[model samples]
Structure formats: structure tokens, C-alpha cells
Target: MLLRRGILWLTLCLPLYGETVAGRWHAAVKTPSGEEAYFDLEVNHSGGEWQGMLINGRDRNVSSAGSFDGRKLRLEFNYWDGRLEADFENGELRGAFTRQSRKQVLARPFRARRTPLVSPASAPSVDAGGEWILDVGEGGGKEMWLASFEQDGARLQGVLIPVSGDYGMHTGFVDGNRILLTHFDGIRATILDARISDGRLVGTLKGSVSAMVTGRRPDKAGRQELNSSSLTTMKNPREAFRFSYPDLEGRVVSSTDARFRGKAVVVSISGSWCPNCHDEAVVLRMLYDRYHAKGLEIVALGFEYTGEKERDLRQLRLFAEKYKLPYPVLLAGTTENAQQTLGQLRNFRVYPTTLFIGKDGLVRRIHAGFEGPSTGARYAALQQEMTQWVESLLAE
Candidate 1:
């Protein structure tokens, strides 16, 4: 009789349990400078499990694997092994977003409230909705960025494009003369707090790395900086490109394998943490599927942040699984050791540097980086250009 009563009581409270995690969240992580880097999430409880999504500028990456056992919640951002765990407390959820490697566990304090209303700013003092130049770092460490923005009323959406690639999108609001933008995509977070003085935008970029950033209107000379696609090249262009690395199963896959002989091949140098590399993977899979039967092949040499073999392989596998890639992705080395990993390559300035090798086994074309869909024309142009490149190589 007592057991029956407990079962009936639990059934009555099931709807209340569902209400605990069924709303949108405004999540924040504390940066090193003590500023909150923000992102949004929307979670739903269905089929007796909790599913959520990490909301970035133009991406809603869904967490298909997670659980909520009444009071505790865990969400897995499996695309890159980003995880979030929290507990219900005082009408809010408190937790830590974490990433793991064999050597360390990196965690950041996290807290979230309900998604709040979007209020327009009092008065917009400047239109941050066009092309500009953002310079980050100083001296040899400096990189020039192409800032493209879109403004509607007081809300602002923008992206910073560098010669290497873009950092995706940043969304914020313009209040008076100051503009604040924040982004948290599970693995990394960024807070851009800047104010307009005269005609220049000056601010500090805070997150994993802190630096002062400056922006200005670009002149004709500054516009020429974007033409950098052909700069990276091989130390010996006449020599055929070759590499040997281990796949996930410890099988050494080499460029000189019989399978690639007399066939057009594409070699991709990418990393686990690179957003641009992730974008390039999708197009690669489509091309492989379309032309694999017509003597075309592709391979990705993954250089990762962590040097531990297990952790790096896991990330590489997850990246491959996300795009359902059929090609062999091999572990090359840590990002810092890329020069040693690819001895013949020079001027490697980006995470994703694609090499187009003709049937003669010599690399004929190289693209420095890839910009995703958010960059509009550049993204479309790369896809079209590469498709034609692949066709020409196969034709040869």
C-alpha cells in the first residue's frame, strides 16, 4: 500500500518536473578580466530526455545527448566535446562549462537566468553597419581585420574577417556611444567592449586572451589587404606533396598509398578548434561524394591544441562524425608543431589551408583560408571556385 502511494505521488508531480527545464536561458561565463561572456540556450524535455542548443550569432548547435535527473542537468556539445553541467538553485541554474584533455580539465563558472526581453537603446549615436578595419595586437603579433557590420535601430550584428579566416559573428547593441558584444560557443568565449571616440572605435577584447583592439574607417590602401589567397606556398613547389600520419585506428595512411595513385587529391590542413575548418569540412564531404567515383580523393591532416594522442583522436573523430566524412582524417601533430609536421610547407598562416593536387601528384593550387556562410559572397565564391578547381584537376 505504501509503495503504491509513492508511485501515485510521483506521477502527479511529473508535469512540475517538466517545467523545470523547458524555457530559454541567458547564460554567461566569467572571463579572466571578470567580465561576463554571454550566450543563449533553449532547452526542451521530450521523450524522457533533455535536449538543448547553444545559440551563437547565426548558429544553433543542438545538444542531442544529455540528461536531467530531476535536479541536475548535463548537456554535451559533442561536436567538439564541450560540456555543461548545472544544478537548480534559487529559481536559477548554476553550473560550470568544461572541456577536458588527458592533461587537464578546464572549467568556467556558469550561471543563467531566463531569456530577457530585447530593449532598444535610448539613442543610436553612430552607425556601426559598414566596412572598417580592426587591428588586434601590436608589432609582429598584430593582425588586420575587416569589420563588416549590420545595424537595425540600436541592435548591431557584425563579423571580423582576417586574412586567415573570420571569427564567426558577433551580436550586441549600440548604447549612446558605447558598443558591447559577447559570444560563448561552449569551447571559447569573447567579450568585445568598445566605445566610439571621434571617428575611431577603441576597446578591449576579453576572454581566453585579453588584448586592446582598435578600429577605423578603411582607405583604398587598406582594402588591398584582403587579396592574400595565393601567398602561402610550398618550399619546393616542383616536388610532389606527401605526408604519412596515423588514422584513428593507428593505421598509418600515407599520401603515396596505392589508392591515390594517378588520381586527383585534395589535402586539407585543419584543426579541431577551428570554426572555419568546420565550415570547410561540409563542402569537402559534398565534393567527395560527388566525385569519388571519378578518380578524386581527399584527406584531412588534423593538428589539434592538445598533444595527447587519445584526446586529439577523439576530437578528430567527432569532427569527422559531425559531417559524416568518408575520407581518412589523420592525426598530424599539435598546432605549434605544424612546421615539423609538414616539412615542405611554408607561410602556413591559417587553420584550413587547402591543397589541390593534380593526377600528376603535384599540388597545383592552394587557398589560404575559408570563410563560412556568414561572410556571404566570400563563402559562396570559395565553394564555386573549388568546385571548378576540382573539375579541372580531374579533367587533367
Candidate 2:
């Protein structure tokens, strides 16, 4: 009866296990590199399935779900550029995340505790309205542009307009003094020890792509100057290039058209898979609304990852449907050869590039990446300056 005695002892320990996991538990999470992060948790029972969500520290309402089994937990979700799977045990949570061509594991220990529902006063009143800018070193380093933060009930979420590239959206919430934000690049970060002061949200925001970058109010004059210089530095305005792409209906649209007569044109080289392109599309829509009556037309050329030309066109059309694009989109070849597809175009490396052709049919500007209107105060100033530039060009 020795085996029977062992079974009886195991049954007694199971009751203690059940008691240990009767309530909810939470913790601040981060990747090993300390860039991507989130607020994670589990609500479980000893012998029952446990369920929880990993909330975006920046945008509280943006969350993904997970499961737990008493002493163990696993979370599966998507972030800006990667997929995540975290494991939890005892009073700690850790795991590995993979994306693009990289992989990362949880290097640090995350302490687990029960997170009580924060009252209204404890939540952050982040007036993210003003223009914001992120400076993340060089090499076209990572940068974020936040337009504003919106509140709904006890929840908060904001849109992030990226300046560096076409990273989809950065959404999150402000839990007490902590900021939990996630990017479209498949990464998340929690900025602990945050506080508001002087009508601006001042705090250290962390991420997997960069270190603990600080967020603050953007300077107006500096932003204006930056925009002016960036827009005015076009070295080759006399350059001319040819473009031929098929529209959504399998019809070919080219740069050399008799209807062009003497009018300026904006050609957008983008794809539906890009988030930066989304921001650019919205801003372009706004501009088109203001200037389409002035004989200005925009053509969106999508270079998608899918090999089929028809599939690429459908995807582009879907993206247009979702965003209510006002311009006509064309599908280029699916060879991943953007420069080749542009025929005689040069220096075409970046995606979501914009080519501004003057009334004379000569390229005036080749903007490399799209910095949406919501990046922050700097982006606002940039938009104002850009509007003036566009008006001047149109008047000329």
C-alpha cells in the first residue's frame, strides 16, 4: 500500500496548488534587449484553464490573449514586426520572440503581482495632441510620430505616425505612472516611472528597437527648420523618369499621357503591407482634397510581396477600400525590382517613396519615406511648411 500512500500525498498537494492560483496575477514584461515590452498577466485555477491578456502599456485597449495552467502560462500574440510567445512560472514570466530575421528571449526576470483596476485619477491624462518627434540616432534610425491620444471611458489609445519608415501603428495605454505601448513592428515596451508635467507627458519610453528614449514636447522653430531643409535639399529637379504600371482593372497607366498636358503629378510608390504608406495615404488624401480641383492628380503604384500581379492589385484595392483612398492605385510588376520596374528611375531603395513631378514633367522631389501628420508637433509644423511649399509650387 506504499503506492496508495504516495497518491494520497499528491492529492493533498494539489489542494495547495489550487489555492495558489485562485486569483489573478500580473507583471511588467520585456524582451531580453529591453526594447519591446508589455503588461502581462493570468487569471487561473489549479485544475482549470487560465486565460489572460497582454495589454499594450501605451494603449490599454490594445491587447492579445494567453492561457495558463496553475503554475505555468503561455502567451501567443503579434507585434509590429514579430511574433511573441512568453512563459510564466512561480512569480516570474519569460519567453522568446521572433520576427523578420531575428529572434530574442526574455533575459530579465519579471515579477508577478495582482494588478488592481486603476481608478480614474490614477490613470494618465496624456494630452498627446501636440506634435511629437522621435530622434533615434542615425542610419535612418528608428523614430516615432504621435499625433494625439484619445480617451474612451476608462480606456485610452493613441495613433503613432512613424517618421522613419512604414511601421503600421503604435497603440497603447497609460496605466497609472506606467506607459505600455506596442508597435506594428511586432514589438512592445513598457515605460515605467512616467509622469505628466507642464501640459506635456514627460517620461522615459522604452522599446526593443532603441533604448529608453524620452518623450516630450517638440520644439516649433526647430521642427520648421528641419522640414524646410529636408524638403529643399532636392539636388536634381531637372531629372525625368518613365513609369508604366497596370491599374486595378488590368489597364496600363504611364507617365507619358496626352491628358497630362501641363499639370503637376504626384506618384506614390507604396504597398498595402506597409504602415508608413497608410499614414502617407491619409495625408495625401487631405492634400488631394484641397488641391484636386487645381488639376493635381495622384497615382499610387503598389509593389506588393505577392508574386501574382492580380493578387497584388486586389490587395492594393482592399487597402484602398479600408482607408477610403481618394486616388487611383496601379499595380506594378511583382518582381521585387522596384528600380527596374520604374524603367529609368535611379536611387530607388526605400519603400513608400514619393516622386513629385512638376508641371514641366520633370521630377522636382523624391521624398524617401513618409512621415505622417500625426508624428507630433514637429510633424504638424512640417505639414504647415509642406503645405506652403506645395502652394508655392502650384502657384508657380
* Highest-scoring model, lDDT: 1
Q: For candidate 1, lDDT tens digit of each residue in 211-253? A: 7899998776423356446768888989999999999789999
lDDT of each: 0.81, 0.54
**Candidate 1 runs further than 4 Å off:** 1-16, 101-103, 115-121, 220-228
For model 2, where is the 10-residue window of minimal lDDT? 224-233
Model 2 CA lDDT for position 225 = 26
Top candidate by TM-score: 1
TM-score of 1: 0.89
Per-residue lDDT over 35-77 for candidate 2, one digit per residue giving the tens place of the 0 to 100 score: 4343444444334543444343322222234454444444443
TM values, all candidates: 0.89, 0.54
